[model samples]
Target: MLGALLWGVVAASSLTLGALLALGRRWSDRVIGGVLAFGAGALISSVAFELSEEGTRTAGPLPVAIGLAVGALSFYLATRALERIGRRGGGGTAGLPLALGALLDGVPEQAVLGIGIASGEGVSIALLVAIFVSNLPEGIGSASDLLKAGRSRRVVLGLWLAVSVACALATIGGYGAAQVAGPGFSGVVDGFAAGALLVMLVDSMIPEAREKAGEIAGLLTVLGFAVGAGLSVLG
Candidate 1:
């Protein structure tokens, strides 16, 4: 349990760090775009090599497929609802969608950490690195947008912190659940996360990166994917 919690915190620490960076300076849109592009690449790699591969191995194709469909659909519906509320723009939790989106993305990633630990395989270094790297730009991008939208710095930081804590708890839960259910279930969980993450990338992260950075975003994304994939192979 302690190990699971530690891994969770270590991976999620980037959220806080990213928040601080976003809050600390006035980064140009281009720079923020580049960051998002890199993050998008890392997330794609994580879903492919870390989550999907292991999921297929553990849970078999059918369960993994079901999990993926469920995850993607859930995130899509939730995001749409939240986005509509955000557009209302009447100060009724305008940043809720941003925070929830981050949580949606991070929880599954952190849960995988717990699952891996519980399986007695220790951490997936590749997944850990990918998640941590991916989160940094998410933090920066969300914070930047919220600030521009007139959100308070304290609220922004608090939201990320809350999500971080939730992710840590998710790790603990994943570890416990894995222990009870056995490793066969890991694939379903991982596949669910992968699907959710992929949808999120297409729904927001990738588009945001391109909108801010333009054509070069594609190259940066590829570069990020190469680095992430290389790390996975090495790990």
Candidate 2:
């Protein structure tokens, strides 16, 4: 839990950097889109090379697949609910679904990092650090999207704070659960997280990049994927 809470600070801090850039009114959609594309690729690849690799070895692909399906479905359901709420006049709904969905998705995964720490601090730190890096584009993208919608800084900051706190608390809970559950627990958690990320990469990042960042930017996305994958070799 402590680890996750700390990561919350990291995530918030990373976002803060992006937030400042946004406040300066110097945001670039192309840069963000490109980076997000790369991040999406990195995340998807990370699952195949890392998460699933570990998960299947620990338990079996079945349990992992089950968790992945659950996570993906959770995202789908949440998105549907958000769409309904937006249609009902959720205020600034037009430009906010993707960002909101990310907020919903990322919080628990960070908490899972906290849970993983209970068993292995080294492992927890590595995973948290990696996810933190990944969250960089996410934070920037959300802030940029809200800014483009002309949201007030007060509103943006407030929303961000609320989301961050909820994420931290959830991380604590997830970590606690994993601590009690034993080995297979991490695999299950990883499966769910990777699944959700996979969905995001495919459903959100790719389309967004193609529309905003163009092909060159898309290649950077691949580069980021390779770099993220290479990190495992260092470990």
Candidate 3:
């Protein structure tokens, strides 16, 4: 739990740093795209190797298959709901909805770390770190967007700080819940997280990178995937 909290601080702080960079208008698109790509890659690999296998191995292929399908559908609905949230603010807030998906992915996975330590699950520290590694680019993205909106640095930092705090609180809540839910129940939840994350990769990050950064963004996306996947295996 302490470790998770520390990670929360680090994640939030990283975003704050990104926001500062964005405020200066000196942050590179490639750097930002690379950041996003890195996170995307890490998340994808973790789902594929760690969570996917762990989930199916525990629940059996049948349940895992069902969970995966359900997860995807749930995320689809979530995406629409986020779109609604984005529409709520109109204009720039359209992308804001996607942050909910990011929160979903972040909090639960972080909770998994907290719960894992409490339960004596080996290597959970590494696992949470993987999730942390995935979150940095997202912070950069959020900060970059706010900067573009002509919001003051103070406002962007405040917004990101609030978002980061929510992430921490949500992680704590998720950790407590996952403890009671046990492996099978948590497996399903993890599956949902995986699906939601993929949606983000395709729906939010990919398009933004493709549009703003073009081929370089694409490369970074691959680099991010590779980084994520590699970390999953090694971390």
Candidate 4:
């Protein structure tokens, strides 16, 4: 449990780090977009090698398939709800959607981390790096938008800090839950995370990256995927 908690914190710390970096200086859209593209690619690798493959190995395909469909739908509905709320609230809260995305993405990702720990598989270095890498762009982009929208630095920092704490705690929660759940549960959890991540990538990250960075984003994404896949192979 302690190990899971610590690993979670380590993974989530990048959020704070990215927030600080964003607050410290202005980043060009190209740079931010490039980072997002790279992160998206890394996440894809994680979904493929870490989550889906492992889930299939652990508990076959049925539970994972159900989990995938459920998770994808859940994320879509939740994101739409958040968008509606943000629209009603006005443009002053432009950053809310991205922040919400980060929260939604973080929870299951870290939960799966905890599940891995409970399964005695130790920490997956590939997944950890992917999560950390992906979170950086989320923090940076969200904080930057919030600041541009005239939010106080304190509020932006506080929001991300809260998100970080919540995500970190999820790791502990997942670890505890996995201890009592059947083995099939881990596969479901893995599929759930993968589904959410896939939706997020398509819905927001990829399009945004392309809009900001142009065609170069594609190359960066492929490069990021290769790097993540290499790490998984080595691990």
Candidate 5:
């Protein structure tokens, strides 16, 4: 349990780190776009190699498929509600979608990390790196936009810190849950994380990266996928 908490904190800390980086300097669109693209690629690799594959192996394709459908639908509904709220709030909504994505997805992601830890396989390096790398750009992009939208630095930092703490706790929660749940539950969690991530990548991250980085975003995404996939194979 303690190990899960520590690993969770380590993984989720990147959000705060990214926020701090964003607060420290003005990042160009290209840089932010590149980071987003790279993160997106890493996430794609994680969903494929770490989450989906493991889930399928653990339970079977049926539970994973059901989880994928449910997870995707949940994200869609939640995001739509958040978008409406953002529209009503005007510019204060800047960078909010990314933050929303992070919050929705982070729980399951960290929970999966906890499940893995409980299984006695120790930490999954691929999943850990993917979560950390993906979170950095989310923090940077969201904090930068929030700052531009007239939110104070303290408010932005506070928001991310809250998100970090919540995600960190998910690890402990997952550890506890996994102790009683069947193997199928782990598979479902894995599928759910993959589904949420896929939606976020398509609905927010990828489009934003393309807009900011132009053609280069595609190449960077490929490179990121290669690196992430390589890590999964090696680890």
Candidate 6:
């Protein structure tokens, strides 16, 4: 449990780092987009190799399928709801969905970390690094937008900090769930996270990256995927 907590914190620490960077300087849309592309690539590898593969291996096809469907639907609905709320809250809260999006993304990833540890697989270096790298752009982009929307620095930083704590606890929760569940059940959990993550990439990460980076974003995404996959292979 302690190990899981530590690993979760290490992965999520990048959120704070990105927030700090956002507070320090205004980054160009192109730079932010490039970072988003790279992170999106890393997340793609994680979902494909780390989460989905392991999920299928642990439980087989049916559970993974069910988990995937549920995860995707849940995220879609939740994001839509957040968007509605943001719209109602006025232009100043445009970043609310983005901030919530980051939190939503982190939950499943951190939970998977705990699940892996509890399953006796220990920590997945590839997954951890992917989440960490992905989170930086999320934090920076979201924080910058929030600041632009007139959010105070304290509120922006506080939001990231709060989410960080939640993610750490989520890791512990996953570990506990594993203790009480079978391999098949844990596989479902893993699949669920992967499903949610993939949807998130499509819904926000990829689009946001593309909007900023243009055609070059594709190449950068591939590069990011290669880097993430290499790390997975090395690990």
Model 2: weakest 10-residue lDDT segment is: 93-102
Best by lDDT: 5
In terms of lDDT, model 4 sits at: 0.85
Question: Candidate 1's residue-wise lDDT over 68-121, tens digit each?
Answer: 887788788897877677568554433344456568768877888898898888
Lowest summed-lDDT stretch of 10 residues in model 1? 90-99
Q: Which stretches of candidate 2 lie over 4 Å from their true place?
A: 1-4, 90-95, 124-126
Provide the TM-score for each candidate, comma-separated: 0.94, 0.85, 0.80, 0.94, 0.96, 0.93
The predictions' CA RMSDs to the true structure, in order, are: 1.8, 2.6, 3.0, 1.6, 1.2, 1.6
Off by over 4 Å in 6: none
Better of 3 and 4 by lDDT: 4
User: Per-model C-alpha lDDT, please?
Assistant: 0.83, 0.65, 0.64, 0.85, 0.89, 0.82
Residue lDDT tens for model 5, 1-235: 9999999999999999999999999999899999989988988998899889989999899888878887888888888887788778774467877887787778888998999899888899988888898899899988888898889999999999999999999999889999999989988888888888889889988999999989999999998898889888976
lDDT of 5 at 142: 87
lDDT of 2: 0.65
| Model 3 C-alpha lDDT per residue in residues 1-235, reported as the tens digit of each score | 6655665565445544555556666566666666666666677776786667766765566655665667667667877765676568664553353455566666555555555555566435446666666666676776777666566778777876666777666555655675677666656656766766777777786677666666776666677667666666675
Each candidate structure's count of clashing pairs: 1, 3, 6, 0, 0, 0
Question: Which of candidates 1 and 6 reaches a greater lDDT?
Answer: 1
| Model 1 residue 114 CA deviation in Å | 0.7
- Order of all candidates by TM-score, from best down to worst? 5, 1, 4, 6, 2, 3
Per-residue alpha-carbon lDDT of candidate 6 for residues 83-147, written as tens digits (9 for 90 to 100): 77767876444455556656765776788889899978888887888788878878888888788
Specify the poorest-scoring 10-residue window by lDDT in model 6. Answer: 90-99
The prediction achieving the highest TM-score against the true structure is 5
Residue 124, candidate 3: C-alpha displacement in angstroms = 2.6
Q: Which stretches of candidate 3 lie over 4 Å from their true place?
A: 1-4, 7-17, 61-75, 78-90, 94-98
- Candidate 5 minimal-lDDT segment of 10 residues: 89-98
